[model samples]
Target: MNYKKRVVKNNQMTNKTKNKFTTHNKNKKYEQE
Candidate 1:
């Protein structure tokens, strides 16, 4: 479902965007590692 996409976009709208993006990036890194 697009539900997760909606929350992710909504989070990117607030100050939490940076934190969320940072966390997402970190998770991506761990996934690759």
Candidate 2:
């Protein structure tokens, strides 16, 4: 059970990081345009 919770937490963090990375890339692309 504890391991499952850790996995869930890690997944949440990864999703947040992925979201941030995508937004950053999009902004950079717009700047280039």
Per-residue error at 8 for model 2, in Å?
Answer: 0.2
Candidate 1 Cα outliers beyond 4 Å, as residue runs: 1-14
Model 2 segments more than 4 A misplaced: none
Q: Please report, in order, the local distance difference test score of every candidate based on alpha carbons.
A: 0.88, 1.00
lDDT of 2: 1.00
lDDT of 2 by residue, 1-33 (tens): 999999999999999999999999999999999
lDDT of 2 at 24: 100
Per lDDT, the best of the predicted structures is: 2
Cα deviation of 28 in candidate 2 (Å)? 0.3
After best superposition, candidate 2 residue 33: deviation in angstroms? 0.4
Q: Put down candidate 1 lDDT per residue, 1-33, tens digits, no spaces.
A: 699999888877875878888999999999999
TM-score per candidate? 0.53, 0.93
